[model samples]
Target: MTRPVRRTRRALQVAGAVGAALLALSACSSSSGSSGSGSSATSDSSKSSSPKVSGTVTVFAAASLKESFTSLGKEFEKQHPGTKATFNFGGSDTLAASITGGAPADVFAAASPKTMAIVTDKKDAATTPITFVRNQLEIATLPGNPDKVSSLKDLTKSGLKVVLCDKTVPCGAAAQKALDASHLRLTPVSYEQDVKSALTKVELKEADAAVVYRTDVKAAGDKVEGVEFPESAKAINDYPIALLKNAPNAAAAKAFIELVTSAEGQKVLSRAGFLKP
Candidate 1:
């Protein structure tokens, strides 16, 4: 009886080994059937999850928006992975002229609605312009209030070398409106081409005071002291942004505009002294 039991145990072990070999062959055949299918699925998923977008997007923005826009452009590139943003920062009117004159720009951000209107009226914009921020003028003077230019009236004092933006730029236009409303005439030593330049003149001590956007003065930090004047309330400027009619990369342009109008972007602008539109 013991010999018979041992023979039965051996037969069971051999049968188990034969079953395991058959199962291994079955798995190999099934894997061969799907050969490249699993890898193809993984490749498809990767491609869909993160599409590669590579190109340089040029943004033409107002001079007052330089610091904030520069930071925002860097943030945008980080969010989009492979996309790059190149900015051309200058006077709103000058940037508008460049865009209309066939400069390759994916986006245009103006310091004033009037400047944006110039592009929209000519149908040079791809979409309707959106006002993203509002800014007002301030008197930027030498640090520690050396000029004693406390109000708009002080700008008219004799022998005070004042600097103002040319009428073509938004800051200049706002300054002119404010001065006109105050019934005061200010003859600056120089008419700067842009707000940054006007602020620079004051920072360099070349001009006693300059009429520029409040945001510009804030961005300059301790370089120049900003003097708030009541007349600035009468000349608030609205900033607008839009995609160019012939943007080289429309999708990326739209994405960048959305980011700028987002909460994070607003915070950056606000820190630079811009008011949300």
Candidate 2:
């Protein structure tokens, strides 16, 4: 071959090799860039999925949870500056019904598992309910024990104007169980809709005595007196809480549940006479 042709051939070969090397480098750089882009997208997606807990969270809770939950709601708002908590406190059954019936609520804190089951059974709970506390029945009497009531049997006395929660409510159900365990059939002058109503009966001196929760009696303080009974141990009510399936403020709802199950929340509950689960 001619020297010129040979030189040209070698130059062509060198140029081809360089071109291939450049193509390979370009491909590697493109692959690396794509990988980084994919990672960044995933990171952004994760951040969006877990948004900050900021918004209005509506909570439906049992009437008995009024005091402590109200306190917790305030603390939750304080922790998350841009958040607000609205509460609807009533009978667990009533609250469960409201939630299942499509009431706009973010959380539910029932006074009993049976009531919470109503929400879960309807697939309205975002997650499985957890028992946060336990409560037992107690006899609440007028301040100073003016009726001289000392025991559950005393509530059965012929002339005593005893009050009790409605049979459907957790407190009433517990009171019934205690009565059943003792083999005593005591008729109440009235069956209150919720624990607070039963407690109110005693607090207002409308009834001589009322079978209510120990927590209710303690909450009443100077307005009523509490008497512990043995049968109460057998009729403990488990209070369960959960986030709703279609929570309006999901992030805030989750944060609120975390707060209620946290150590700080337990302290408030204990101070209110609730037993930890």
Which candidate number would show the highest lDDT if scored against the true structure? 2
What's the true lDDT of residue 23 in model 1?
100
Model 1, 49-136: lDDT tens digits are 9645567778999999899999998999998888899999998988898888889999999988899988998899999999999998
lDDT of 2: 0.92
lDDT of 1 at 182: 90
What's model 2's TM-score?
A: 0.82
- Predict model 1's lDDT versus the native: 0.91
Expressed as tens digits, the lDDT of each residue in 66-154 for candidate 2 is 98899999999999898899999999999899899999999999999999999999999989999999988899999889878888888
Per-model CA lDDT versus the true structure: 0.91, 0.92
Collision count of model 2: 0
Model 1 CA deviation exceeding 4 Å by range: 1-53
